[model samples]
Target: MALEQLSALKYGKKTDLSAKLMNIHTKLRRYAAVHSGHANMQTTLCALAVDEDERAFAVNVGDSRMYRCRGGCIRQLSTDQSLVQMLYEQGRITADEKKTHAQKNVIFPVLGNASEEPQPCITEIIGGVQRGDIIIICSDGLSDYITQGEFEEILALPMRLPRRIAKLAEAAIKNGSPDNVSVVGVSMV
Candidate 1:
């Protein structure tokens, strides 16, 4: 479904992509609910769309993330829709506390059996990408194990995209990630 959204974004208007994404979300929710008796179907998702004009659009649900790297600095573009994040936002916990919070892994909005509409975090990069900028999309398995400083350190390395992505996954495994790890990195030329 995400791939279809990306393909649509390539040829469709950026402003229209949000509605398309919402449609996809709705379908996923319905499918999950219908198949609940046959399969375990909850999931966190993060998607990125880069248009011909080089602008970037992101939609995320649950704890998956998207990040932007430029000038040796890495910044997270997608906020985790999890209980820990909400606690931090409400000033009930410190940033450091969030990392080890017991509810850190408790995601609030996931793609399954929804009683309410899914609220995906959507972001737009207005001027598009520039040379030397890097974009990364990954699941919580990778983000949960790697610190932001570690992400910066790895991303700053002068390596090809495939190697960098491999190294990111390797680091997560080495850090004892208990979930599936997926990472995709794109370097803007």
Candidate 2:
């Protein structure tokens, strides 16, 4: 599977982030098919769009997840596109085992593969943005290593987002990540 992460400042076309994100996904799918050779493999695109004007932020994705830890509440802002998620939705997997299951990372759609036409799953979440709101976009590796509560604790520290991201990578390594770990954390200053 291919992995990608991008965090950019909002200068222009703030309203077009969704379209640009979709375009990136389209290009990624073609690249995956021609090079990665997994045509049938599905793609998952997770994105977070911040709208300072509307005083809100929007999250969209297939498998990648976003989370917010404010005050004492830790909230997950994205959905997983995995068999385990399906099972969880169908009431087959318990809420506690959702992350501990062996197939927790078995995403139904990822970024690459060239065996068949790729289809990407998308999910969106919307909420108001606080001045110190912390937004995280990360691969399953990092997510699997640290629970949402742990992430909240991490964010609570007085550290920069980039440093926090590095800490996340370190945590994943410490937890024995078998796959590459990627993480991007953006905080509204």
Candidate 3:
């Protein structure tokens, strides 16, 4: 339902995307609060949008992610909202420990209600989206299983956008993904 609302909007500039995302979250939060048995229900989102000048912006909430492949390397464009990620960022935990943390799956900056939980979602401007760059928006199921090197390897192949998405999703499941996998890919031509 949140995804459906996001798909219908226009995106441009940092403020535009920020306000739109917040509005969507606000509306969805109200709906879920009144109708849902689970008051804390939340979901993740990862999106890439292009403006009239062709500038790209990435926005995300929860643990979903957006990645940009440029100059032969893939970079994560979105930050995770999980507690494990926060601990690692603050130097309280190591990279390996982030994976093994007891609350590894506790995600934050949730879309449900920011008033109840005070974490702001992240938004980033994707600089210099070039002809050969690739952008991928995906769920954790895909992001967790696809390593940096493997992503580079698969994306280096001479395949169309749809085929690349297919292979990536397939690889995630083959790698024993514990949750649903979804991927959207675009190779900037």
Candidate 4:
């Protein structure tokens, strides 16, 4: 349903990326309510879109994530909407505590939340990816097991994007990730 909503993006004149994501969010909420029948359907999303000029835009909800790596450094581009994240923000838990927290997987904002519609965190890159820059979009399954440093190490390696993604998935599994891992990687031309 979200995909259906987003498919219209390239049809018309270019629109503000954030506004387009907000429209998708609203559509997803409506779609969920109509189809779920009160069974509490939900799903997280993390996606990055890069324009012809390399300008980047991203939208995130729940525990899915987006990251950008450049020049041997990697940084998280989206904030998690999970309980542990809330605790961390409120000074109730240390940063390390979040990793081992009892409720690290509890996320409130998602693509399909009937109780409360999600508000996607929309981010715009002032000047997007350059040559050698890497953009990663992944589910919690991948993000939970991969470290920022590890992401930098793998993405910066002298390999193709597909190989880098394979290495990331392998690393996640090697690190004992118990959830499904999904990874998408983009490198500038």
lDDT of each: 0.77, 0.64, 0.79, 0.79
- Model 4 scores a C-alpha lDDT of 0.79
Q: Which stretches of candidate 3 lie over 4 Å from their true place?
A: 34-41, 114-120
For all candidates, the clash counts are 0, 9, 0, 0
Clashes of 4: 0
lDDT of 2 by residue, 64-148 (tens): 6777656646687777767788899999989888878997766664444334333443343456657677777777778777866
How would you encode candidate 1's per-residue C-alpha lDDT over 70-171 as one tens digit per residue?
888887888889899999999999999988898788887565436555577777765456788888989888988998788888887787788888998999
Per-candidate TM-score against the hidden true structure: 0.84, 0.72, 0.86, 0.83
For model 3, what is the C-alpha lDDT against the true structure? 0.79
What is the full ranking by TM-score, best candidate first?
A: 3, 1, 4, 2
Model with the higher lDDT, candidate 1 or 2: 1
What does the lDDT read for residue 170 in candidate 4?
95
User: In candidate 1, where is summed lDDT lowest over 10 consecutive residues?
Assistant: 5-14
- Which of the two candidates, 1 or 3, achieves a greater TM-score against the reference? 3
Model 2 stretches astray by more than 4 angstroms: 1-25, 32-43, 51-61, 111-126
- Give the Cα error of residue 175 in candidate 2, in Å: 2.2
